[model samples]
Target: MTVASAVPRLLIVAVSARRQDRRARLSQEIAGMIERLGGAFLKAGQLLATRVDLVGAELAAALGRLHDDVKPMSTRQALLTVTTAFETVPAGIEAAVWTPPVASGSIACVYRACHDGTDVALKVRRPDVARRFAADIAIVAFLTRAAAKLPMLRRVPLVEIADQVGMSLAAQLDFSREVEHLRRLRTDLADLPDIVVPAVLDELSSGGVIAMEYVHGLDRAAADKLPAETKEAGLSRLVGAVYHMLFVDGFIHVDLHQGNVYFRADGTVVILDAGFMFRLSDMARTRFTQFFAGMIRGDGEFCADILLSTVRHVEKGADVSAFRRDVTDLVARSTGAVAKDFELAAFSVELFDLQRRNRLFAESEFVFPLLCLLSLEGAVRRLHPLMDFQLEAAPHVMHGLLLTDAAVT
Candidate 1:
């Protein structure tokens, strides 16, 4: 009788321990829930990671590392999704069929299949992804407006942030638009066969459904095994393509990290994810050009003036001086390293943690610029670990900055 009683108590303790473990995992769960909440949080996280000016450094770093990982539902759920979306089973219309996805992300899942004797990838957006985003956007917009009215948030300008978020999220939800964006990118880079954009089959594509040619390649980890020359060539292609996109084309891939980039067997670069591209406005471009030039020229004052003008400052009760100091320190650290042979190109999480503790910016306004800089940084690191950035990016940045001055003149 006592043993029986002890068994029940032990079971109770086990359940209690499980609950405690779950409670301890609450933070991770919240991060996941933030993503599942969709629209606002994902958009916000992306923006925050980019905006070293708004969300603080540590959070931005954390946000930057956040992936679009999602839990995949069953095949039955996928079938229901297709049936609800297009009023028919998508598998029937295609020349080939795909099983449920091998991988899933926040917005969509990718399935490998053969269609019309040609291999293709079937990308299906989660059924609730759109609806969830729509609802979240509304809530975010409302909150942004409310936040903007608050004295502390006026400088943050949540309303404007919301507008950017709303527009960006809306664009992401439209698969057709993504197809066109990819097509444009492909056309622009037609001369370069070292990169390939998957072709979207229009007949098989709908509002949230896209069928495209599958390009197989090695992820970053596997690519490390390749010969040094091939690796160099691959890195060159990736960097060159990105440089063209940002400096020459003026269209930026908002996300350009390793996972979004893949290496083919022939040493080509394959870019994925079309949902977060950014096209700079003329004025914004000019301002950024000036900023880049200022950095290239090592003109701190000029850069400061441009930054002050470019960023929306709080009307009052904010530490503008501290903000300036933070920016200066960041510039010094990041650029100073460019000139040093032994300096690491990578931005460590600790740097972000320090910045956050110091109360630096929090939003994603700076993501694109940082991305551009880091893309080059990453490329150089991959190709010539001993490279002097002054030799490579400075001239281009200087040249680009002159455009800003010319516009002002």
Candidate 2:
């Protein structure tokens, strides 16, 4: 009887090892497959990387490469896509000054054009990119349904999450939406003069092709070389602007990775790639604002309340009192670190893990912005780590909260 019991214990150990190895292999394969499955798969890889709590560290590590490493679509195909989008090369692009694509990616390529007597960046969608996005999203839907049957995974609103991913990708594939995103964000930042959102060249822009005035300047690499004082000031303005967008406007870019943002000599911050933007619902905005305020104040109880309100589908029979206690402890423990070497990026990662362990299901739309904030933190750290993001952001965030005082939960 003892020997038989030992056999089951050994088998359990063996099975766990096998599962770990299988997950590692699957993660690496997905890293490889994403490049081949270029369109929506590439986008989905980014979202998956953010959910280390759900997907595990091995998979997150593999999918992290999709950030800036995807294979660019060939130039020939990109030009053909542009031709398709415009029906024909317009007069200025047809002239002696058509430069090759300045940048290319799975969904689109950007070319510099002097069209309509204006220097512009013409963004052209990849051929059949929409169809590829649809296919990839279908696969996500299938997997979500299959996974939802499990008791642990069932806490996640898998179907709703998959639908959210699909909608985000669909919006991205529509270049027109990017123009609107740029326009709206520009308006939101009108009070902040140091921020430079691209000027949309409306007359030349169309469905799959958008022509925006091309502003030439330093990218992230050059920005890193700036004198410390200049970089710190610019970082402050950038952080403050982002806080305003997230809290006040409620519409913000979901992809603000270092490569997609740049800084100029005059301490002006320039941002690109507004295709993947997130708009918070009324409840999400209020909850997030409360949580952010609580974090800054080191108010554990307030944060716990907001955390519970923000998450969806809390498992039945869960100990609600215990959950609040755990969240409160997390906040209290982090207070010392926040006063010392507080990195919001790392904290967000920990928060995601905490929420997952506590069976709090945050939807993709909500989870994604936290990751976006993490990315912003990464970018800002590279620029100036010593700058106090909370101090810089407090004014904008407080103003936003006051405006929405009626919605506070």
Q: lDDT: which candidate is best?
A: 2
lDDT of 1 by residue, 46-80 (tens): 54444433444444445543443455655655655
Write down the TM-score of every candidate.
0.67, 0.79
Candidate 1 segments exceeding 4 Å error: 1-69, 80-98, 138-153, 191-193, 218-220, 223-233, 308-333, 339-392, 395-409
| Candidate 2 lDDT (Cα, 0 to 1) | 0.71
Candidate 2's displacement at residue 268, Å, is 0.9
- List the lowest-lDDT window of 10 residues for candidate 2: 1-10
lDDT of each: 0.58, 0.71
Candidate 2 runs further than 4 Å off = 1-34, 44-76, 87-89, 94-98, 310-315, 336-364, 406-409
Separate clash counts for every candidate: 15, 0
